[model samples]
Target: MEILTDYILQFGDLNKQQTDLIASKAKKLDLHKDDYFSEAGKIPKQVGFILEGVFRFCYYNNKGEEITNYFVEEGNFVVDYQKFHTQVIASEYIQAVTDCKILAFSRKDWEDILNTIVGWDKIEAKIYQKCMTQAIERRSPLVSEDATTRYLSFMEEFPKLINRIPLSYVASYLGITQQSLSRVRKNIR
Candidate 1:
């Protein structure tokens, strides 16, 4: 909760009462490896803040292969805003990459915070902006760069995650096969 408070504080100032309200609304959840936080074809009830471990945003392609869209590590937020805010069923999945501890709050509580707290909308807007920027950074390389270059950029962007996450997931995220990723790694070495 302190980490979440600090993360939010980075974007906007929150009064003690507001911070307390946020902390009160959140609940801790432990997810084991391979557990799904939000699954495909379901409406997500809660927004999760990663307190520990990593998660991947993924979906099955037409070929029935799972494609990793991105990863969320500790000190980050993970919610499919289109589905969560619009109350629609999600087309993608959010799954724990490892055992994870998360702070979750229902959509109702999130709305309550938005309505009750002053300047929260501004803070949320900034958070969404950051999320958008990150999405762009993660996707743009796939369109313009070679697989090896994309892997290099991934290393640069997520230096801490390379060793923590599975290489298969990283290869999927880079739009390359696991063998290709191995070759890239070998070449780099």
Candidate 2:
């Protein structure tokens, strides 16, 4: 709860009562590796604040190959943001890449906070903007960089996370084949 509240506090100030309200509504969730926190085509029931571990945002491509687009680690929130706001089905999956512990709030509880707490929407907007910025910073380079460059950048940027994750997921996230990733790894070594 402290970790979650600390994260939220970074975006905006919350009085004690408001902070308590959020803490009371939070539910602890534990997800094993490979578990889907939210699935494609399902409406997410809760928005999760990661306390520990990593999650990968992925979807199937036209040829039915799984493609990873983003990785969310601890001290961040995870949800299909657009879908959650509109109460629509998600088009992508948020999957646990490691054994994870999260603090979460149901959609109804989140709405109650938004309705009852002043300035919460502003705080939310700031957090959303931060998430968007981080996403762009992580993803933009992938578009123009060669696969080797992408892999190298991924390593330098996420040294701790890369070792904890499977190379298959790393390859997918880098938009390269496993064989290519292996070749890169070997050549770099």
Clashes of each: 0, 0
Question: Which is the leading candidate under lDDT?
Answer: 2
* Model 1 collision count: 0
lDDT score for residue 158 of model 2: 80
Candidate 2 residues 53-85, lDDT tens each? 999999999999999989999999998888998
Off by over 4 Å in 2: none
Model 1: CA > 4 A from native: none
Q: What is the model-wide C-alpha lDDT for candidate 1?
A: 0.92
For candidate 2, give the lDDT of residue 187: 95
Give the Å error, residue 7, model 2.
1.1
- Each candidate structure's TM-score, on Cα atoms with residue i matched to residue i, is 0.96, 0.97
lDDT of each: 0.92, 0.93
Per-residue CA lDDT of candidate 1, range 1-189, in tens? 889999999999999999999999999999999899999999988888999999999999999999999898999888887799889999999999999999998999999999999889899889988987998877887778898899999999889999989999999999999999999999999
